[model samples]
Target: MTDTLTTLRAQLLASVAVIDEALKAVPPEAVQLDLPKPAAFFDRLRGRLWPRMSVSQVQGCERILAACGHAGFGLAWTAYVLATAYHESGYRMQPIKELGGDAYLSKYDTGRLAERLGNTPEADGDGVLYAGRGDVMITGLDNYVRATVELRRLGIIGEDVDLAKTPERVLEPAISAAILIYGMRDGWFTGRGLDDLLPRTGSATVGQFTKARPIVNSMDKAAPIAGYAIDFQAALFAGGWA
Candidate 1:
C-alpha cells in the first residue's frame, strides 16, 4: 500500500480500537434498550424492494464502509445507510433520487440551482454549480456553491467553475472523512458538536446514545474478531467518545 493509504489505515484501526474498549466497560444490558436490529430493518427493506433490489445493493454500501474503516459504530452506520439507500431509490440509478438529475431537487437555491431559482448570478461566468450527490450525503445548491468557493479558497478547486455544470470533487473515504471531520469542526453539522447536539430536545428524544447503540453493539460483537478492535475503543475514550 501507498504510504498515505497505510497511514490512514493505521489511524482508522486506532479509532476502532478506542470504540471497542469503551464498549466493554459499559454493560450491554445498559445499552440494549437503545439498540435497534439493523438486520431486521434490512430484511424488511429487501422484501419491499422485491425483485428490483439485489445483494449487490448491500455490497455497494459495505464497500463504502470498508473504505472508511469498518470499526465501531461506523460499521453499523454503513448498514443503516445501505438499507436506507436500497429502500429509498435503489442506489441512485433512478433520476428521482439523484440530487442533480431532477430539476425540482434544487429548491434550496444555492450553488448550481441558484441561477435557475432566479438568482441574478445566473449570468455570472464565475459560478460553480453544486450538486450534493453521491455517498457523502451532499445536499442543495447552496452547499455545493459554498463548497466550490471554499475549495477555491483552499486552492483545490478553481474559482471560475461553471455553476451550471455539475460539481465534481473527490469522494474517497479518507477525503470524505477529512471533509466530514473538518466540516464538523468548522460548525458545518446541523447541531454544533456532540455537546451542543446532545442537549437539544430533538437530539434528547432520539438520544445520542440511542442513535449510537446499534453500532456500539455491532462493534462489540465484532471486537473479538476484528484484529484492531481493542485499540479502536481506547482511542475513542481518549478522544472522549464524543
Candidate 2:
C-alpha cells in the first residue's frame, strides 16, 4: 500500500524513537568487534567481498555513517545500510545506473509492477526515466517522488528540489547516502521498516540480516547480502564505527 504523508510522518517519528532507544541501549564501551585492525580489515574486505573496493567506497561508508548518526541509527542499522550499498551498487559503493534497456525497464510501466510503483499504465517510459540510481537502486516514479518527500521531511533536501523533475539529483553522493538510510530506516521503498527485520531495533543478529532484505526487495540475494552485512559490521568496527 502507498504510504500517505501522515502515515509516513508517523512512521518517521516512531522510527526516530526506536533509533534513539536503540542507540542508547549500546554500552558506552561496547566494542563487540575484534581489535581495531583498520588496515587488515580493509584488506580482507577488499580482497574478498570487494576485490576493487577503493577509498571511494570507504568514504561512501563514512558518509552513510554520518547520516546514520544524524538519524540516530546505531552500528547495526548503519552496517546494514552499508552492506546494502555494497550489494546494490555491485561493490562500486557509488551511485550506479540500473542495468537494462527500454524493453526490459518498460515492464515496470504497466501491470502489477506499475501498480506497485504508482506509475501510469500508459507504458510511456516511466521505467526508463526513473530507472534506479543511487546506493540502493530505488526505482519507479512513486519511489522517486517518495524519496523527494522523505528527503525533504528529513531536511536532507529542500523546497527547491523535485526528484521527479531532476531525478538524477538522487545520484549525488549526499543524496544517494541519504536515500539509502532514509528509505530503509523509515520504509520508504517498502512498508517493512528495519523494525520489521530485527527482533529489536539496533540489534540485528547475522541471521536476521537475511530478513532485512525485504527492506529493498525480496530475498533475491539475501544470503550473500547477509554475509556482506556481517563483513561490513566487522570492518566498520575496525574503522572505529562504534
Candidate 3:
C-alpha cells in the first residue's frame, strides 16, 4: 500500500476500533435508536463515528467523502449502502446463481439464452434463484442486467460477459463492493448515498435515507468510479485483483 493509503488505513482502523468499542457499549437496539436528525446531534454522532469505521470500510468512506465533499455526508452514505446490503445480502453470501452457483439462474430467461444455457440450475442442485447484485442492493436478473450494461458502459466491467457464468463477479467482496459503489453511481433504484449515511444514521435512521434524495443522486453519479478504484486496490491487497 502507498504511504498515504497505509497512513489512512491506520487512522481508519484506529477510528473503527474505537467505534466498535463504543458500539459494544450501546446495545444494537440502542444503536438503532440513536439516529441523527438534528444538525447538532448528527454532528455529535458524526464526529464520534467518523474516526471509527474499519480500515476497509473507512477506505470505502474516503472514496465517498471525496466524491461528496462532505465528511458527514459520507458516513450517511456508507450507512445507507451497507444497510441496503444488510437488507439485500447481509454482508454475507446469498444463494443465487450470480453469487451462489450457475445452477441458481432459472432456465426461463434471456440471460440463459444469451449464455447459450452454458449453466442452468437443476432441481437437485442449487435451488435458490434470483439473487441480488450491486450496492443499494439490486435484486433479480432484471436489475443485474441493467447494472451489467451500466458497468460495461462505465468501463468498470466488460460488456457481453455473462454475469451468470461468472458468479464470483457478483460475490467477490471487491467486485461486490465496487458494484455497490458503481450502482450508486449509476443511480440504481434511488441512487442515494446510503453508504455514506450508514454510520450516522445507524439502524434507527432507516427512514432518513428515504428523505435524502439529492445526496443519493450525487452519490449515484460518483460512487461507481471511486468504488471501482478503491475495491480494485483492496483486491490487490487480498491478491485477487487480477
Candidate 4:
C-alpha cells in the first residue's frame, strides 16, 4: 500500500512538472498585447454592443482582456473570450442570469433542468442557486464545485470560499476573468477548450469566430456572439493590439 501511494505521488509530481514546462514554453509575445483604455473601448463598442456597460465595467472588461492576453492567450482567443463575456453577461461586464432570470430560477427549481445540471432531487434549490455566474456563466452544481476547487488551486480564491455555496463571488472581475480564461482554456466549463473551437494556426479568421459557439453555450445566441467577436477583432486591429 505504501509503495502504491508513493507511485501515485510521483505521478502527480511528474504531471505538475509537465504543466510547468508547458507554461514556460509560451512565448512572452503571445502573452502580451497593447490594451485599449476604458473610454476608448466603450466608444468603439458602444451602440453596437455593451450599451449598458458603465465606464467602470468597460475598465473591468479591458482588465479581463489584458489578463487573458498576459496569461498566453493570443488575439483570437482573447476576442472570443470577450465575445463570450459580452453574451453571457448581456454586455454588462458582470455576471448575470440569462434573460428571464427569475423565470429560469423558478422553472429550474426542479424538473429536467435540475437533473441535467447535476442537482440531485434531494439537493433542493440547487438549480436556482447555481444557475450561472462568471463571464462564461459557470452553471450547474458540478461546475460550481469544480470552479471553487480550481480557483482555490490557482490561489485566485481562498480555500474557505466554496463557490458552490456562494455563487456570487463568481461576479468579481478578477475572479471571473481567472475562471473564464482557465475554464475555457482547460476545458473545465464545457469539455471543449479554445483549441477545440479555434485552432492556433497563425492568424485569426472569421470562420473561427463563427465556430466558437459550442465552446461556451450551445447554439443559443451563437450568431450574436460571432458578430461580437468580429466587432472585437476590428476594435483590436484599430487599437493596434491585433
Candidate 5:
C-alpha cells in the first residue's frame, strides 16, 4: 500500500507538470483575436446589417474568441455563435437587455411560461427584474438559475454569485461571452446544443445553419441568421481558423 501511494503521487505530479507545459505552450496572445480583414469582412455588414460598427463590437468579438479558447468548435460553430449574437442583439454584438422595458418584459410573469420560468406572477416583478440579459439573452428566473450553475461549474463565477438575484452581472462582456459560448455549447437555452445541430465531425452546410436556429431559438429568423453565419465564417478563416 505504501508503494502504491508513492506511485500514485508520482503519477499525479507528472500529470500536473504536463498540464503546466501545455498551458505555457498556449500563450495569452494565442487567444487574442486579430482580424486580418476587418475592413473587407465586417465592413460588408456595416451599412447593410449594423448602422455603424464601434470598438465595443470588436471587443465583444474578441471576448467571445478568448472565451472559446481552442475548444475545437471549428470555424462553422464559431461563425454560428457570432451570427447568433448578431441577430439576438440586433447586430449590436454586445450584451443587451431585451427591449419593451417593464411592460413588455412582464410577459414572462404570467401564464404557463411564467411557471416554467419560476416567475411569481404579479409579485416581486421577477419577470422585469431578471428579464432577458446578455449576448444570448438569458431570460427568466429558471434560465438565470441554470446560467449561474453553468458559469460556476465552469469556474467562470464565484460560488457567492446568484444570477437570479443579480441578473445584471450577465451584462459584463466576459460574463456575456461565457454565457453565449457555453450556453450554446451546453444547450442551456434549449435542448439542442451546437454539436447537436452541427456535429463535431460534420461540416455545417447552409441548410444546417438554418436548422441550427433551434440551438438558440425555435426557427425564428433562420434564413437571415444562416446568411450571417456564412459571412461570419469567412471572417473566421481570415483570422487563421484551424
Candidate 6:
C-alpha cells in the first residue's frame, strides 16, 4: 500500500512538471494564454465562494486551461469555463458535492431525479450513489456513465478507473477538469453546448449568456452565473487574454 501511494505521488509530480512545461511553451500570441497568479486569483475570489483557493487548486485550474487551449478553446471558451467553475464550485477549484447533497440523494432516491438520471425504480441506491459530484456537478446514473465513457475515450481516466462505479474519482483535479471542459464544450452535461450560447466567434450578448444556465442547471442560478462570467471576461481582457 505504501509503495502504491508513493508511486501515485511520483506520478502526480510528473504530471505537474508536464503542465508547467506546456504552459511555458504557449506562444505569446495565443489568446489569454496565461493564468492569473495565485494571489491575484484568490484576491478576485475574495468574499466570493472560494476566497482561499489553494496553490494546488490554482495549479489544477491552470493545467486545465492549458489543456483546453491545446484542444482549441479560445479566450471566450476559457472565460466561460472559469465562470462555470466559479458558479459550480464557488471558485474552490475542486469537485464539490452539491449543497444539500444528502437531502437531494434521499429526496430523489426513487423520484424525478432518479427517473431523469436513468436510475431504474429497482435501482434502489442509484440516486445516492450517483448524486451530483465533480467541478461541474455530474449528477445521476446516466451522466456518470456518459462521463466515464467520454473520459475513457479522451484518455483522461484509465480503463481501471470506473468513474460510474467510483464517482468520487470525479474529484481528481485532472479528471474533473477534463469532465468540465469536454462536457461543456461537447454538451455532454446537457444537450446544450457553450457554442449554443456564446457562439464560435467568442462573443455573447447578455441574453445569450443567461441562456447558458440550462447547460449546467435548469436556470437555477442563471443570472448570478452570467454575472460571474462577465467578471471573468473582464479579468481576461485586463490580462490581455481576451
Model 2 off-target regions past 4 Å? 1-41, 199-203
Badly placed stretches (over 4 Å) of model 6 are 1-57, 101-103
TM-score of 3: 0.38
| Per-residue lDDT of candidate 4, residues 1-242 (tens digit) | 99999999999999999998986985443344466543465567777775565766665576676777667676688778888887777677666555556666655566787777777765466766877777778777888889889888887788788988778887766778888888888788678788888855334677777777777766777777888888876666556554
Write down the TM-score of every candidate.
0.36, 0.78, 0.38, 0.76, 0.80, 0.75
Model 6 agreement with the true structure over 82-112: per-residue lDDT tens digits:
7888778866666787777565576556867
What global local distance difference test value does model 4 have?
A: 0.73
Every candidate's CA RMSD: 15.3, 15.1, 15.3, 14.1, 11.4, 8.2
Better lDDT candidate (4, 6)? 4
Give each model's whole-structure lDDT: 0.37, 0.78, 0.42, 0.73, 0.80, 0.73
TM-score of candidate 4 to 2 decimals:
0.76
lDDT, model 5, position 174 = 73
Deviation (Å) of 91 in candidate 1: 5.0
Candidate 2 lDDT by residue in tens digits, 1-242: 45688899999999999988986975332213322455765765776676666788866655666666666666678778878998888887888889888888888888898888878888788878888899999888888999999888878789999999998898988788788887887788768887677543344678989888999998889998888888877776666654
Give the poorly placed runs of model 1, Cα more than 4 Å off: 1-56, 70-128, 140-142, 145-166, 170-189, 192-242
- Cα deviation in Å at residue 135, candidate 1? 2.5
In angstroms, the error of model 6 at 131 is 1.0
Tell how far residue 106 is off in model 3, in angstroms.
Answer: 8.7
Q: What is the lDDT of residue 62 in candidate 5?
A: 66
**For model 5, how does the per-residue alpha-carbon lDDT over 72-141 read when each residue is reduced to its tens digit?**
5677888899899988888778899998878887788787878888787665687788788889888888
lDDT of 1 by residue, 76-133 (tens): 2323333323222334312122434334543434454555433344334222234344
Model 5 scores a C-alpha lDDT of 0.80
User: Candidate 3, residues 1-242: lDDT per residue as tens digits?
Assistant: 59999999999999999998987874233223222332332233233334333445433433332222222223344444443443344333221223555554333233444243222333422223334444334444455556667667766566656455454366544445556655654455454444443344223232445444443333333433233333322322232111
**lDDT for predicted candidate 3 compared with the true structure:** 0.42
Off by over 4 Å in 5: 1-31, 34-52, 201-203
